[model samples]
Target chain A: MELNLKLNLDASTLKADFPLLGREVNGKPIVYLDSAATSQKPQSVLDAMDDYYRSINANVHRGAYYIADLATTAMEETRSKVQRFIGAASPREIILTKNATEAINLVAHSWGREYLSEGDVIVTTIMEHHANIVPWHILCADRGTRLRWLNLNVNGNLKLDDLDETLDGARLVVLSAMSNVLGAIPPIRQIADAAHEKGAVVVLDGAQFVPHLPTDVAELGADFLAFSGHKMCGPTGIGVLWGREDLLEAMPPFLGGGEMILDVTTEGFLPNDLPWKFEAGTPPIAEAIGLGAAVDYLADIGMPAIREHDRKLTAYALRTLPGRFGDKLNIHGPADTSERGGVLSFTFGDIHAHDISQVLDGEAVCVRAGHHCAKPLMDTLGVTATARASVYLYNDESDIDALADALERVGDFFG
Target chain B: MPALEDLYREIVLDHYRNPRNRGELPCPPAKRAKGFNPLCGDEVIVFVEVDEGGRISDVRIDGQGCSISQAAASMMSVSVKGKTLSEARELERAFKTMMVIEGGGSPSSPADLGDLAALQGVKKFPVRIKCATLCWNTLSEGLTTE
Candidate 1:
């Protein structure tokens, strides 16, 4: 027997904590199902930001004064926390970034684009977000290398057998651990092993995976991993790129500035060591503290429990939607929760995704629509765009009910 | 079978399935252009054969996308075939304006929209606007550069 998941948010807690969830869209309580886009911040993360600003607002890394020292300590604390959260080998392995886009870009521009020789093959999958795909394409374009892809299975899962075909000449394999649209969680550990066997390093796009699933950089066997804080219940404009210590030591710093250098002179340039080499100028001190607090908040509940909650929610959505709408609904990903994460991308009767999204908005049931930055996957799925309802821990079965009800209304409107 | 009105006007389904003038013409001494909506995986190749006095002798399109894109392309081919280049450009602009807004009704009069009017409901689909305008954007591009 399953306990009914309750969305009866404590009014005081909601008002005191989020303060934004109290917002009414179209005169209805907003039921956000677009966690894949980004997540809602908790009160702890917000308070951490406030605490940083109020108490220890100063530049980090090169500071000498008390406040600066505090900021530096907070910054390094976050590095350690992040390193532990992702199971990185060392705190110096985590490089602070602007976003996941920039994290992938650092690898492209710093490692592959600058380091790899011309004509080298870069292997990726059709399921990658444009963040992962475009950077590699740009790198390939600049370096005169070839960028190839492994196609997805009928259920939208990446076919790892294709890796043998793809990894022949590949110097690097970029894999998105979980797709934002299809919600298919690829066998990243297996793919990493294959890439490693082929002497190709694997980079995991953990933007979608890290927030929803339990991850270990070592256990997964990824050489590099990138994720954004906003998607993981933290502040915006902050991301982390964790690499193996040896890899970070070998790759050149992406950005050159005051902080990321050993010494500055008119004669020549000498780069700084490990993580600091890549960090560059003034880092986001307060945001990093907020992210650290967010990690603490998430860890308190444990990711395994959260993943379990989403698994049940996704299974509920898939099973109930077809029963209610029958032939009117078309789910785009795997039929079971075993292979997929928590996304329920679909079409309702004759209602287009855009039309359905708007009607769902009218009912305060929000979801993402369009290609979702995975155009190749969209083409493979034979849909130009789809309305995607992805569940996180905050989302419950009631959220599913709201979405199903609104989808029915959209069907009535367009069917 | 469901009624035509229940799904779409019978003409819409007809256009979507057996699209008219669906193949592209070579850049035959005339203007041609391409357009794509990377967000939706839509690509359009438009070729316009202009007769003397800026009149369109034929306008053909080639592309692959969802039903909205394909049907809109088919409708656009017929809409501009006999019209002047200026008329086609105006229809392109009008079609674009209609697709951006959700639930904005068609051009009020059937004669006002002509064949392109069938896509008026595309306005309700904001994400599908790219799909609806794939052909029109290519036509606009052709009108300007080619």
Candidate 2:
């Protein structure tokens, strides 16, 4: 079969931007296909972080020195960039957290505890990553709240037919815009509208969606959106939790220390204003700067182009793998590429995912194999684990060809 | 490229394809234990029947895992089925010593391990040592449990 490779951006020139891609694994060139786990940072992001440390390193907000002011500016600039990247209303709505996991936890602890109570139902999907699932589970267990799960259809997307009924008594609905395992992009706008009609606030986990697709917070109609910098070519320690300005203003601070408090008297303390109220202590200043640089880099390339690249790559994989491997490979997700991102999770023959991962490592093909931290989704799919191959802007047809070649080797070696 | 022959040795594949002592032992004096490797969802349930003389009269291994894990379990069952409990424990120690991360050379020579020595290649792949040792760990837990 002919390969219809529609690459929006030239990977050859962009390949040099990520230094790690030039390195070798084992004896062969590293075929890094695990961008869903974490993308390799560009030299620009690294240089920006290094520049921050070299020139403008200081404590944010509290310091009176020149460097401190510059540092604060850099940090806030990142917040604005993130705001613009996701199309949030204002910078005041974006709260910096350690990671996406921490961001979700912040929502669960601050918002869930404050607004939700006994018998208050919160709806989440079967395909949510552990970060989104566990926090609500803990909140429900603690506050006597009832948790409802939206099931997956045969296509691996959330079955929204029963969503309105499920959201009837639900006070909140937290859903991922995309599945990390199945790569299924759900109808976030429709889900959000339905939840709002039922008087429930919607929280979208944009960790998988924001990096691969164009995310407009207002357009999506979600009250809160959370994502990490690491998955989008920045450093690991910084993440953004963007909430509706009104919602963020109403909720209490998640963490408290030096910065989050307006005044800490002996008897009591007053909380700081929006964003800062949620961000306590010294934040990830350097990582935030790096994230801003990464955001700038993505903006230069354009999210539309990146989205197209991902869809075309996903289309290529979906069309090629099954035709080549036939029944030997079983891919999980929507059959159509338009319904999913670039992530492909599958099993080759009866070989377990761990084994496939190990064998692929022989070919320097770095794919993720495990539950993908979505155990409930794994249960629904009737598999314990699957090997996931995900693509980003830097990847092209050569990477996919390398992957297919390695998978063929895996098939033959195992046989 | 990584040397595939070292990892997927002929004997290892044989045990994986046609595992020995797989299934359940009837209850009465038999004891069963379940173990899970949450990393890759490898689950093994070991059933052991110990005789009055403290020898393992029969041992059955049942699990679903990758080739390495399943093969390791199969080899482990074959190695320790007829041996006394103490002897099984000694072999377990030796096997773990072989799978150790640092200087992972076999403690007991190849002659000492007999058929189980085929798994010595697992020591090279650090991530896979747990897969090789899962059954042995499960067996230890099974024997110790009342």
Candidate 3:
């Protein structure tokens, strides 16, 4: 796809919408580059959450009062918003959880527990976050199942040459849509198609993908999609698990409590319905409403525009970082901007990532420095940790320039 | 805001650039303990050979980490070598006290911390305190274990 200049993603104007962006750190303006970890919430999302707490503060589903109805409506409205945002078949298919990790865990506990057994095989990639990898590891350990890893090539692309062979006997395929560390966007649609042809269910970890790029569940060909609200300018406690309606109906309740059951006598209880059967306790009411506002904010700006902005910023970083530092910088992802997201994980000379991060903090340029919760991928990359600077819709060339400028300081300090 | 120089002192950087006693000892004679900071993937392996006279005969540290962690381990190795196990324990206590005290104050007693005193600046950077303490904790583990 070509970069469309018609998109209205002015980073300076959008930066004003997020209150946290206005703050200063260490006497300098905060240049946040850790959006892959969590995004700064916009004023609209904060207002939506504040409004819920201020006006419609009540327990959902149980209270019969006026505010209770408003609370329930506000929360459920988020489900519909997420459903529409991802183009899900229905809101019933969207199960709200604490975060993307819990969303993936729900699939492992509810669906994997029922379907998987001894001799079954699960296929996952080395590039997945621990959230996507560990749940399947638990299920495999529990059920005596085997896990097959799909390794990546030197350029960080998945080795899809033998994808059919890998998916031959796999019962389920779990992988990240975009690597949190490498920023490599795997060919999820092609992998999903291959998995389906082999009669395997595809579980997509969209935590990193959903926050940056335009996403459509059907287009991705995933049986289930999991993403977090916190990474997308929403509240921390809310996440989404979008599954096929029939698949969710067939799975058992993940957590059992008051709201998940219809009739709870002395005997075993019947699960409630599609989404509620999974959401056990009183959900994150204000957080869900905040996520709804976040969805509205992104929709208003348009995902395409946000994506184009990310592309431009990423392309600039890809060029500028290497152009300035030459062989001193080693960026660990696909070199092409088209094949990657805005995440820039790199090692500058022999300086350790933490030391680099410490120096960057002195310049008020915030970046993540660690294994990024993907230890297995870290092993594959042959590095203990990397300094990561990820761009978002509110980031522009100036942010990238600041990152490059700060990196020069790293060279001066460590050289 | 703590300056970067506060966290990465000249002595700390010196030790980082040229770490001392940075190799593993044979396990049959030396007790080895591993310390890892999972958040940053920093790993430190400490080998301590406690003599029958209760003195730390030799100490070696082998690992990879940021300057703070590596330098701390390097300083820790030099500080405890040839000292009695109890004296080493006292140094650990004094160093930890320095790390934990508010305003990065000196220890209550006049404990001879030597090069380890440079790590008191790490207290200013709260997030990096654990990095300075990782090797000491590992050495403690190594000395205590059979």
Pairs of residues clashing in candidate 2: none
Per-residue lDDT of model 3, residues A120-230, tens digit only: 999999998999988988998899989999999888878898898999999999999999999999989999999999999999999999988888899999999999999
Question: Pick by TM-score: which candidate is best?
Answer: 3
Best of the candidates, lDDT = 3
lDDT of 2 by residue, B47-101 (tens): 9899999999899998798888889999999999889999998888888877774
Q: Stretches of candidate 2 above 4 Å error?
A: A1-7, B101-105
Cα lDDT tens digits for candidate 1, A268-380: 77899888899898988888998999888777667777777788889998889899988878887777687788887887764557656766877888898778987777777
Ranking by lDDT: 3, 2, 1
Question: Of the candidates numbered 2 and 3, which has the greater DockQ value?
Answer: 3
Candidate DockQ values, in order, are 0.21, 0.73, 0.83
User: RMSD per prediction, one decimal?
Assistant: 5.7, 3.4, 2.2
Per-residue lDDT value at A16 in model 1: 39
Give the Cα error of residue A271 in candidate 2, in Å. 0.9
**Which stretches in model 1 have alpha-carbon errors above 4 Å?**
A1-17, A113-115, A162-166, A349-351, B1-31, B38-47, B60-82, B86-137
Q: Write model 1 residue lDDT over B23-84, tens digit each, in one string.
A: 76766666888787765555678888888888998877787655667778888888888898
When 2 and 3 are scored with lDDT, the better candidate is: 3
What is the number of residue pairs that collide in model 1? 0
Compared to the true structure, candidate 1 yields what TM-score? 0.83
